[model samples]
Target: MSKQLDESEIQRLAAYDIAHVVHPQFHRADHDGAVIYESGSGAVLRDVRGNEYIDGLSSLWNVAVGHGRRELADAAAEQMAQLAFSNGYTGYANLPSIRLTERLLGIVYPNMSGVFYANSGSEANDFAIKAARYFWYTSGQPAKTKIISRGEAYHGSTMAATAITGMAPFHKGFGPEPPDFIQVPTCYPYRCQWCAAKPGCTLECADAIERAIVEAGADTVAAVIAEPVHGAGGVIPPDPGYWPRLRQICDRHDVLLIADEVITGFGRTGRWFALEHWDVQPDILTIAKAVTSAYVPLSAFIASERVHRAILEAPADAKFMIGCTNSAHPTACAVALRNLQILEDEGLVERARVMGDRLNAGLARLRESPHVGDVRGLGLMAAVEVVQDVATRAPFPPSAGIGPKLARAMRDRGVVTRVKGESILFAPPLVVTEEQADRMVDVTGDAIDAVTKGQA
Candidate 1:
């Protein structure tokens, strides 16, 4: 069942578009014609003009439960009618938020005890860093304000969050970023800088963290923040033994390890969290996206019992304080809780494991494709890099913008994807059946071939 938006509604949606109210992640001057997506159901979205497209990127790496699930809508409506907005500030408690905390922590890969709610992933990670710093500060580690992150990683966009991001593009204009943040090499095995002959390669990428901690003076480093499996920095999966070694390094240095699971949490990986893949536990965790399957804006940061005890030690006046007006909107929390239920009830986690294997198999067949320099991913998340030369692994000339062109071609063939740098990213909803996933790969491969002219 779909609700088709007529022409009049489309015009109405476009009328008040001064760009701020409509365009996002794009320059206002470049605001193109708005495609009003009217409604969606399992795996498909219908636009204002009635064109349908399969959600290839899961609506920005969320939407794990797909679209138009009646149960989600009903759950949101029920909670809204009962109680919609109440402050999460100063001992105020709400039903959906409370219930969701139980449900979320129930699945916490590391048995996190306390949770803090926020409206988006950026805010969650930003606040997580704050809490980490504050935890050490209150414990007499005043010098422990610096946070260490990885190169090419994206934690958030807020100042503290941006400071933690590993990508250079985000920091081009924002110089003199917070001094506490430092970056080591990201575990991008495909384009690994540490991948070379036996002379100097010993998976030193993980060893780089120990070097970073030592260089920063372990006494001053508060935490090490990283995505379990890097996203937005090019869906890079860690090499074997990477996470466990990182954990051991963090333990040796006494720095808290924060897993920014905003993108890989909630079954984006075959497991609930990518860290689970290595049986590693983190001191702090942050997640958004598929938490509510994009039905609502919700994000959370969870702290281990050890970190929670830091907050408990504070006096009443010294209680750690951080919140927003929409911190745990009941409707959103209700939807998130139900989203988890749908995942569990449907056994989609196991399904993701099986279908993810199928996705890789399809990509495995395309390894010889001229345009595909590398096909890499785990579970439902993966990427195919477009390169101009296989030997040097040089990306296509940025002037050609081949990635965007290929994406447009894929959309024309009824798939929507995104490009991070020169990498073509594919992260479909976990609900995507094997056939739908194959279409995802097929459409992407077809689009690449069409646009690149068999040129690698």
Candidate 2:
């Protein structure tokens, strides 16, 4: 914790890490050794041992502009000197946060008037949930306290955010959950719960909400939250008509639609926001991660004018219901503003579109491989679903640890991929070149082939 250690020294320290570091979501029964990263640049990272690897997962779905961008570094440094820390609470304003809010709202469509800042995606989504409740309370609809979210969704780790998350395992042992949070089916066409295919299926998946509302009682539900493209929960992009139907359903039931744009925002989906691809906007949108390309910890919970007006018209005592110490940190906001400027001027969104198409096609060619079951994605976010047998869609036995094995094999070959459930996720920095995109596909193809063959 004193002077920075050399590689060998770091590895020794890493040895201690293995003995002590309890990484989240890891299978502690067999995981050994610390994975050490040294440094990085435009689309790649190197280990302490000097093994360079493509940053295929963009350091957990952030890193939009990629590593070692001096411009971002310089921006961070300058802001630090001028105003290291300032809270934008109680009508206080800082230049960076004020400017960042204006810039963010500009990219958003149909005009969002207010931006609520937080330190991370989890916190941002947490704020959105609280704000929804606060807005309804302010409007004299105190009974509208419940929130409905989709199964197989990822919001964040905060209690309120996690409460709305529909994934069951994330809630195991930690609950005693809050009242009024409910779950409904996800529009995952690949794993549709209602088996909604040609069999009155298109709207069936989305219509489950109608059932949920009927059961939960429409008056009790305040909002329904979803990721236009579910990121951590298997990168699920809803079916063709799924989102549009949800928009109509929410309108009919008087439930506010909250889009969790934490992962799909800022060109990751080839659009400014993934919902835009579906031409669906939400009453509230929560964003983080790529907002500043992960150069700083910052997030925004945006409100459409309807939601904005509801909050604005509230009596004076609502007290800015939710904000943290770092909510709109001046330095973080300054970096975010500059980051968007770069994304705009460089046309990175267009680049993500062209390169994503090329990579998805390249991956589709490998579907013949036994282990490749599904390749699905939009823009920079992609996933390869591995199965034991594609014909039956049989998963490897739970005892086999198939996902971690394949990921480690890919790592040995100098590419780092993220294994989520049965899928290997690929989300490189948006600045990745076409050749690098091909390399990402090629390396994973090789890894998949080897892992399946080895298991056989």
Candidate 3:
């Protein structure tokens, strides 16, 4: 273990961070209040001040196998010693990249035949967009350039990924919205305007995709991109029938289905991939995060055979020309390969299913609380929706500051998670034990009670 820093040294580091580092989702007002994490092991993290908290969000929906594994560190070091970087352009290749791709193809949808590497989820999704457009362009349907996304979807921060993202906050101050990106309703059963009142899912949200495609003129729509289980968007899993119908809709309209599995891939969900739960295969799939359990920066977009053939057949002048400098960094790929091995050997995926049941069951007890409007999740990923009035499902206004207050309460109670709007998101590592899972639930329930007590 590294030497533990004194309080003064920790404060000095925090001062340096405030001076130099610009974090993502940055809030100027809250910058100084940031928790400076120093070390982690399994589902627990310790701040610079030596306070430990249960990692309820898996350090941002990644780190499936957990943190501080010697094997992963050794993997990176071994690969770096031999070959740290390589040119992954069309003509050049690396062994780790080649082996990792082969392993991915064997595990992912059988129809997928090619993988394009990038450095992050945003870049992977951007490549997904390019691959979708390239397929249509080469197939003589150049007009089919529009991509449809769902509301509450969080793709990434890149320009194209931002345009494809459905959340307005991400788009705000991002300059002009890129053209040809269409937004449609998501399968959010909780606050769904169409079918929330119904006894069962009408799947009106899925049909909304069809409506958008029709409105855009199906011929002009290239692809419909979505997360199989919406992650950053409140951990909302679609209805069981959602993906099958979505597959049919995309097939009927000749629109490609791009599953952004950045957060749900690599055993974060019970299955290796979330769409696999529904037996639905997407035309293009983007995966990252737990591909290496966030030990290193690496991501890739896989293309189905049909899409691959289209790109392969492109004319010399109109070649599918897109590549990243660190496309398949040898060190990252090596680390990812070892990470995959760790996941399979330990059966972390099945653990997620079993532990997910335990976690959800614990959270279900909180439903009796008047403020908890809903409790929902799949596998180890879940959310608790807080509301002002359970009868009307009315949300607390922004001025109430319920999310921030609940977040602070949970942190104080030795749990750390994401509190978005009125929803508290939880995605602990797949390796989280039953005791840790129960502690998270208990802390969440107690935090809710403490934060919302006496609130009208």
lDDT of 2 by residue, 1-456 (tens): 223556678767777777787877555565665467768898888777667888888887889888988988889999999888975787688988878887888898675778888888888888888888877887788899889998889898889888978777788888798888888878876566567334544678788987898788888888999998888888877776888899999999988889998988899889988888878889999999999899889988998888888777877777556668998898888889888988898898888887788888888888978788888889888889999887777789968878888788878877887787778888888898888888888888888888878742
Q: Give the least accurate 10-residue stretch of model 1, judged by summed lDDT.
A: 22-31
lDDT of 2: 0.83
- Stretches of candidate 3 off by over 4 Å are 1-4, 454-456
Question: Model 2 misses residue 406 by how many Å?
Answer: 1.6
- Please list the residue runs of candidate 1 whose C-alpha ends up more than 4 Å from where it truly belongs after superposition: 1-22, 28-30, 196-201, 454-456
Full ranking by TM-score: 3, 2, 1
Over 4 Å off in model 2, which ranges?
A: 1-8, 19-22, 26-31, 196-201
Q: Compared with the true structure, what per-residue lDDT tens digits does model 3 show for residues 135-240?
A: 9999999999999999999999999999988888998898887899999989999999998998989998999999999999999999999999999988999999
* lDDT (0 to 1) per candidate: 0.84, 0.83, 0.92
Question: Which candidate number would show the highest lDDT if scored against the true structure?
Answer: 3
Could you tell me every candidate's TM-score relative to the true structure? 0.94, 0.95, 0.98
Q: Each candidate: RMSD to true structure?
A: 2.5, 2.3, 1.5
By lDDT rank, best first, the candidates go 3, 1, 2
Give model 2's TM-score versus the native structure: 0.95
Worst 10 residues of 3 by lDDT: 1-10
Please identify which of the two predictions, 1 or 3, would achieve the higher TM-score against the true structure: 3
